[model samples]
Target: MREAVRKESEIFSELAEICTSPGYVHAIASLCYQNNILIYADKLTPEDMLQQFARDILVRTEVSTLIGLACKKQLNIDLPSPEVIQRYIDKTDSLLKEIHQSMMLPMEYIFDSNEVSDHNFNPFRDGLVLREPIFYSGESAYYFQYRDLSKIKYEKDNDWFLRNKGFSIQQVIDVVMSIQSLQNDKAKNVLRGLFDKNPSEWTVLSAYKFTAKEVSDISNIEIDTVRLVIESFVSSIGMDEFNSLDDFNPKNAYPIIQLPEDEYLLFQIYSLTQALYETPFFWFNDDKAYKNIANQHRGEFTENFSAERLKLVFGEERVFSNIDIYNSKDQVGEIDVLVVFADRAIILQAKSKKLTITSRKGNDNSLQSDFKKAIQEAYDQAYLCATLLNDKKYKLVDKSGKELNINREYKEIYPFCVISEHYPALSFQARQFLKFQETKNIKPPFVMDVFLLDVMTEMLQSPLHFLSYVNRRTSYGDKILSTHELTILSYHLKQNLWIDNKYAMMQIEDEICVDLDLAMLTRRDGAPGSDTPEGILTKYKGTVFDQIIRNIDKLEHSEIISLGFTLLSMSSNAIEMINNGISELIKRGRKDGQHHDLTLEISEGGLGLTIHCNDDHESISRPRLENHCELRKYTQKARSWFGICIGQKVPRLRFGVNKEYDWVQSNEMDELVQDLPKPQNLEGKNKINFAPATRQSKKVGRNEKCPCGSGKKYKKCCLKQEWRM
Candidate 1:
């Protein structure tokens, strides 16, 4: 596989002799046309298509860009015919595909050597990219973070973008923002302008490609200026002459691709977002004269961007920026941002450092260093704040040295680390390298870039919904394997994001993001994706399940987060079964002679649930339900038991019971448990209710049959047993 990659250099070199620098970038843009990319998926499922494209010939052209930097030299020779050019493209593609296939077995052998396989099944073998070429829809704050940030610090001489890139950041932003403000573009330009001449020839790639004059007209900027700044986004890599060369930092790195016909193509919408959001990451560091001041201010900008996004997701009053923690008179540490709402809190640390290009190319030492600077250090800072927030004695103060008033001592603390820009393979690398300290009080830190934070805030605007997602996302830990954080987040928008058990590994593919992308693109006043989508959590919306979850989010108690954790962690099917049982009990009550109460066992942490259907008075029904719950909790040896009452005679949610999480395994239930009923196990690992046909209680007369179904008087039928105590 390695040798095949080596031989491909020769092919790129042969092809480069015929084209210019922009030509190489152009070839990649043309080959990845939405039409060309999806041709293979026509007959296969998305997963299968993703598999096919991962090893397809069309995807290998990007390598030629890296190996052959065409801006340094130019060929004046006439280019080959269309047939000849395609032959070279096909040859390079086949060799790259062969090399991609060859990588599977050897990588598996290496993984099996040390064997992290014991903890998880090896998914490293499928090193496939999801190729979300049309993902960004301009809702993110990519432009806000990097545009004209240094104007305040440096005045004009050392303005970061101008000093480093010889162009005003604001100018580029004007063009990008204008292009984004097109006619109802659902991630593709719906504006049928001069650029889309001859619909037959124009593929999906043409929708994003635009002429400088068109941009100038829309933005009201000078055509020459628009042309220059737009050119800054174009990669200077042209057609490569086949050769293997030493790796070096690219002098001219751009995300956009330029064509011979004078149109600029953002092959993937990510290219534009990356340009506005991440372009300054290297530029600020590379400028020798202004690097110190520029880098410091860069970090501050990242902190500010994160603080704003946090404020949007969790309201402004709850979010405090640049917080200082003090114990007594001495300062403990500083937190970039701290959010405390209700009983849920978030500790955030922002870093401007990015993964070096060498790290992306697979240098282990560089990967570790870049990961440490970009994520690990931020996590360390957030974790420090998290530990302090857990203790009541520490005071969180604002810049004025006045203590920030908190509503309550937060129980569920979610720590986060936000970066300045996109880091390739960030999620996977964190799983491979992140070493967490004690995480009992707070969850594992979720690391993401500014762009992701923008999208997350836009979609999940409500504090409760965002906090619930953060709770569930952190619970999964490294069990989630994905190339991007957005993929997992996208799944949460469509379905309840939870796995059945701890050891199971879940791979969230990028294809899952298609719906989210389209939603973001086509959203207007007419319609839009719900702030919270229709998923498993919302399946029983307004039912007892929703009532409990909503009420939990608003309540104040030290141990209340524990209950929220259980409810949020319930899988999609788990909530369905419990809610469905309520409906079935109501139907059976209409038939006259049938069981009304339900006792079901949840597979989550040995938890059990019992819904009492009868509308008997609280004086009798409440205690009877409690007694029934206690028996199930002991008999099943569950961690906790929840008892609920829904009415048939009085059809509304009346009351519920919270069996304190104090289960103790002992000989207490040995004799009494032998006769008690249990929920039957049904098909599938993710079943909510095991047995749907179990019963509960009511006020028992001395002569009436025992609630346990012993068929004897309550007084004589072992009601005085020590187990009830």
Candidate 2:
């Protein structure tokens, strides 16, 4: 989107001028505090103001973060000239463009929507989709997919940085507990508040510029310890200290300014936040062995934290950690975290590796290597575990050396690679450098830092809602490009994150994550999002559909996971169509004085649902639902079928039947279905209305021959007033 402005000298000179100014550090630090921490995440400001300020604050952070590294002098954004400001804006547009061009054309993608049902665990990573793109020497043409990523968010959650730049929550506890003086819970919170405050307005910067004694007096920590902690967090530098991006490492970084009479002050808002978080780790680093232990603990904490997070999404009973696979007593591979739900599961492998310092400075080779360790290798382990699990000949065991009981036939396994730290440029790095194994019957893994995972489990609490994300993410992630994982997730939460097959590419802007950031921040404040995730289940919140979703894992049957998947796999329109059909069935049942049921198949032989309606709870019976669902399954030749029993009076779901899968042709069953009422025409009941993303006057490709039989590009042939319609 931007012309490459290669005048590095002019750009750096302008940036240096602004960064070296007296107010640049304080200005950004203040913006970071107000835009992020001051108000509740839910929009308290006017919409236009919020959007504009979000963009402005984002600009401030990128520019300020760059200069904050070594700019010990006061800094401000008052540029030497308008040309300098224009040049800075141009560079940012280039980064935005880079975020959008993240798609690679794979040779093929075969989505087997007829997924397996409960208790039938098939151990493969669902590798039918290719993760690696084929090298094509010849020319190729691609279409443009539509997405809006114009949203902006300026901060990572403060809690994320608290964990030593990369440790998980439990490790956070251990790390903070070990370093009592600096990072213990109260000290950490108070330390940041010492420098930052949420004022009524942002017109005047309101952060405290205080001495060590004033800070200690304001906080609960003892004055002597507070001085030592501040000293440990000291990270000021001379003009020569930084020359490139690589010099900025949060572990040893925070912008500060030297005041009068030999006193130095922390950049109040975000800089102090960084200093506060990174101080604890530095405090323990005085002991080499302790530091080493802490380092190893990082990986362990990631694994445990991932398992805990997964447990939150899919119940604790189904989530297993450190499950070892064996080939006749010889340990083969281990699953860091395995979450099972009937016939579907998610396999996760966590890595503590982060983006190397050199990588952050713009070294391509270092970036690739860092990604390989932090994301690719984790996927490899998870994929291997999935493949082995698919092989019935292998054995599974837990970390306790006991044989792990994994009897269900898992038909679809979503593999995930989780990182210990929030690696910047993560989404782009994945698209650019990650090389997935070319295999069959497996899906591409989604790599994310623990920060996103934590938010995901919190927002999408229902099992089906969470599973729907995995299903959609694995299906369309490669084709969609964005700057952050949260950006993509935020779009999904807002609008289901769907891309129509009509387009070949989609570019998601950063703008969509703004509301999500507010929601997440509100959730952090304990109000839990005045406007959190508004995804697939939002419309059906208290309906029986919602009840089914809430009880997906709670159902006493083995096929609940698959049923949840089947229900979630349907479009929102499809769900509404089913609801309409259920109403019709209820009316028909009242007229006929019998329990009336309907079967709504989402696709020809994909996932389908059978809903039985009755006037009262007494009229609801498992055998009746089971009979109707089984007959429907046999007739439709469906891969998976679920039965829901609804009591008309209660206007709610009374109970449900577990999903049935793996249909077999039987003459007797065929005869039985024939004796039943003839199947109704599915036109109205099965119709799913999903609008086209974009409508053009010319339906043909811009490069393809025109539809009017003119052998010219559609754009050229259709260049007329009538075509505009």
Candidate 3:
């Protein structure tokens, strides 16, 4: 990758020079027009011109076909066919005309001015002089005159630049080929150098100093040859008028092109090269020795890269690489990268084998076969590692032979196959396989998620966000438990001491049966025929058993039992709501004088309550209670029951039930109350008054029972009233 980056940087430098040169741009534009490739030659970048020329070359099949036809029609004559000769002559004449036009076109120039000058004022009148320094703004165009040079600055948009309308890639190719066809080896070499320079190194003044001996030395060409090429190039492009080499040194006349400092330039070059060549150009010319080394070590490199990326994402403490799972007798498997987040573990298997897709027929067969093999190997390795890590009996060791402190209590394990390439079709197949496994009750030790190496690196930066993303794509069976669900469950589990364990268990079993009956009945238009309650229980149990079993070892036995009860309570509440809705519908129907029969039924394959109307047997209402929105609402409500039940927080009762045998007031009771004994009159015996006592009585403790019949503490009862009396 580093080598590729370097090569592309060099290539872009060269192209940038050609792109910014006004003479080269005009010459290319004329060639493009002559070749019938450039519909509009304005604002054309070198990249665009190359793309247009390639398209033109691909489109012109008649030229090659005609040449072949001429070859076949050759007869033994002093001169070849006149028609062929005329065709050739026409092509030559067109090329010459294009060249002449390119020379005649005025060159667009860019100049930098440190000082500003107003167009309305005469600079000479104020004794002001402006110096023109050649400036390159990475564009090609015709002559441009700034109306207000004062307004221009070196900033992005304010910089002086010129360009015609953009040209297509084919036009650029045409321009290159046109330069090639000039048959001037020196000119070709010079053009190649310009094309090779970095974008930042492209400057109008520097491009003109091609005759220097230093340039010849750097380019490995003779001085005379370089000077001859420079002279020919300037004359061809009509730049002879600007030549100042006769009176001034070439080095002093033009500024040296500076090397690019922009870090983003490398990426730009990579993108441009990718656009021009189907692959990076350097890859085609890769050294065999280096290629072999790269291929051999690619796996190790990818593994390290992935490890570092995960470390950056999840913290160094949370990520481990080159983990070896082993039994006492032998090594089991190796994990490329392991990331532990909370109680969840993400095990990654990195496959660095480069797989290619060929254009030949039946090529995909081999590709698919290799892909499947790679996927199987990655999955197997990941599964083995996860299983070992999750089992207490086995042990894991790092590369340095240090035993890892493996936590065997992981609640979730995400096995991933990280590949260098993005193969959507293969990913789809992997997803389908996982879905199939889920349906078959074949819980594959871990859910395998396939990710491109680049994508995995990006996702690792925000692990929680990535997990949520995976949760949303739950169809692949790689969903992580949502934090919301975990939070609710955790809060309830912590408060398990307050839960009525026995009552919860009993209620949960009954609720499960009731919920299953109602759910199965409402699911279809009939009663569950001969299916026993036990059988229905078995079926529903299967649905939640896998989840329950996976979590069983992670919690205490009591907690697991509590969790079962909570799930049952939630399920029951959801079913009860549906049942109540159905009952309301039935009541409304009956009030309207419509005869409807509601029955709970269970079939061997089904369990649900069904409603049937006697008036219309064919048109029975089967409320679609299974709509996801309604089901989710019920599920959430049911889930909330865990918090409510464990917390011992009962909601206020909205309705009351009446019982027989209660106290009642009657006329006889009123007469009996009048005949009850009356206390002796205290007024007749309490006439004596005593002087106020100076001493207070002994204080009574607040906890002591009150003498008053209110059964309250003495301080809270009549203790205060005694002082007032």
What is candidate 2's TM-score against the reference? Answer: 0.69
Residue lDDT tens for model 3, 40-83: 23432323333433422311112211211222221111232334
Local accuracy of candidate 2 as per-residue lDDT tens digits, 382-491: 88888887787788888777876765466678888887554655655666566676345467787776667877887787677787787877778678876567777778
Q: Regarding lDDT, does 1 or 2 come out ahead?
A: 1
lDDT of each: 0.59, 0.55, 0.34
Residue runs of model 3 more than 4 Å from their true location after superposition: 1-292, 357-360, 422-460, 474-725
Query: Who wins the TM-score comparison?
Result: 1
Per-prediction TM-score, please?
0.70, 0.69, 0.32
Clashing pairs in 1: 9-243, 12-242, 13-241, 13-242, 14-242, 16-239, 16-240, 21-238, 680-691
Say what the RMSD of model 2 is. 16.6
